[model samples]
Target: MNKNTTIEEVFQNHERPKKPGALNASATFAWRALLRIRYVPEQLFDVTVFPIIFLLMFTYLFGGAISGSTGEYLDFVLPGILVMTVSMITMYTGLDLNKDIEKGVFDRFRSLPIWRPSVLVGALVVDAVRYLIASTIMITLGYILGFRPEAGFFGVILAVLVLLLFAFSLSWIWTMLGIIVRSEKALMGISMMLLFPLTFLSSVFVNPTTMPNWLQVFVDINPITFVVDAVRGIIHGTDAMSDILMVIYISIGLIVVFGPLTMYFFRNKN
Candidate 1:
């Protein structure tokens, strides 16, 4: 039986793995991304501690000056701070991608028999989880600090869902940069340069009307201004349908522009 074994006998193996579908492939990659968090627990510090720090520091430091009382400013700034915190941290997506490429991890992933975009798709999923964690931390602390959403819990949920959608679209821009840029540090540098103006110069901290004419123009056109307005409106019970729709439109535009670029560089990457 041993010596007479033919090629047909050897070829008749039953344990060959069927290729995973897109969702299954994506979930597997998502698990891999989560394990990195398990091994390097510091990955969570941004989503957890930074939200607390940003909330407390900005609320206490500028609250009275801006709104005449900490309580009043807390109501206004909490939603703004939530957007700022999550948006700032979205750069980590690019940083992680660049790190993987530099370490040649992407090479091994590309050689595998799996849906290719699942790597980036899985990253987007994990970042959404991180963004939700940051949003929850910030909002919960806001509630303890005398902040209340006049639109109540339903509005809070709606605002968060909108925020998560915008963040998902925004990640594609960073993902494209991550594939195009050569180093993680460079990716971070460019991301901050883009994020600072978009967060600070927008209506996150103050009304765009309070800004100078030229600055107001940028603030008016800034996509984040619409997002912050939409979120703040949801919390305050103001009509924000137009702003919400603008945020959605902007999100669609970003995905249309950057999603393909990210994939193009990823596939053609040297």
Candidate 2:
């Protein structure tokens, strides 16, 4: 090809690169996210510091008032705090994607021959690491503060798995927003606006009985409440199967609705 050759001519002359398998392509993009974190360790501030602040602030500030003692409150509230914090942080995935789009990183990825949705899949996979880190910090701090799960070690593991799965599904909503939203700041604002009400208004810091009757209706139906209830049950060795199933259904529905919507916008985005 000559220097004067048109892009169309060049493309015509060149053979199409073979697209890699979905797993391989996704793994590569997931590595890209991890590597970005590795070099810019400060990118982890939200996961690291947010958990500590929420755990300390909420436990001390509302502990006695909510449950009559810090010790009792910690046992009741730590699981909710863990769920709220981790769910909120998952919004960062969308913000990061929006930033990448603003910087034209996705443009470069588009030129590659790999599967289109692999980019989103890989980023979500890397997000699991962030969720894991946040969950660990929350649990460790709770244990240090005298919060103990009645369900024992295995149940704690199960609870973490449930949180991770739900968080992962919820992230798809933000992923769609990131692709469609105009800016990272807008995405961040929108995500927080939705999350704040959901987390705080649910059973995170207080029992629904304490809330007004009208608000109690929303709290009872809130999916985050189901997640908090599910986590509490798992940690306390109570029956959580119904709440867990509810969360799973919500997750599947979100993925069913938003997953394709995100990919459609992603494919259409210039």
Candidate 3:
């Protein structure tokens, strides 16, 4: 036998396929995605700056007009502003996903041995960190501006957790929209089109009682309003248990409905 034939035969007899563990695969993918964010941190500034600017502008411009006193209105509007900021930043999930698809990033992912779900999970985890940072900044800014949460530290923490849960669940909807859309611009347009009505029609800037009867009904039913109201109650200790329960139920329902659908579509698109 030739020297090359002898070496090939020897290795071929001992060679065995190596199987990747589920945990290893997931960790590797998660690390890769996290490192991407670490390398490109400017992406996070959008979440940080927008919330601060909005809070300041609205608090100064309309705070007095809305609540008759800037200090009183800041407390009332801060919770709603927090919710709106989180929701707005979450829209970036779709835009990022759309860009990745357009740039053939999914194809690069396909060439890897990682589990399919790992990709989406990696993205979600990275975005969740951004959301947490943004939330903290908004809350701290509110505090500096005389927005006190009478519910104390523990209650404030719980409220933050609830808001994060709501934001995470809502991200699935935007993630799906981003994947289905052809361009990042289109994705942004579509997400904003849906977000505008949802944001404005809720009890965000103005009290629902100030609206017409029909508008009040819609605002009362809007899920974002419940989230805002629940956070407000947790901070102020003024809202009822029934309202908090409603928010929890609606958030859970959204996760159940959209979470699986997002995964299904993401998998198929990949």
Measured by TM-score, the strongest candidate is 1
Q: Candidate 2's error at 79, in angstroms?
A: 0.4
Looking at candidate 1, the ten consecutive residues that score lowest on lDDT are 8-17
lDDT of 1 at 181: 90
RMSD of each: 3.3, 4.7, 4.1
Q: What is the lDDT of candidate 2?
A: 0.92
Better of 2 and 3 by TM-score: 2
TM for candidate 1 is 0.95
By lDDT: ranked, best first: 1, 2, 3
Give the per-residue Cα lDDT of candidate 2 at 222. 95
Best-fitting candidate, measured by lDDT?
Answer: 1
For model 3, state the Cα shift of residue 242 in Å. 2.5
If both were scored by lDDT, which would come out higher, candidate 1 or candidate 2?
A: 1
On lDDT, the stronger of 1 and 3 is 1
Q: Clashes in model 2: which pairs?
A: none
Give the per-residue lDDT of model 2 (tens digit) for 148-216.
888999999999999999999999999999989989889989998999999999998888999999999
Error of 3 at 261 (Å): 2.0
Model 3: per-residue lDDT, tens digit, 1-270?
466687668777866557666666767766876787789978878778988998999999998888889999898888888888888888887777778788898778767766776766667777777888888898899889888889888877878888888888888888888878888888888888888888878977888999999889889888888888888888887864776788678778877998788778877884
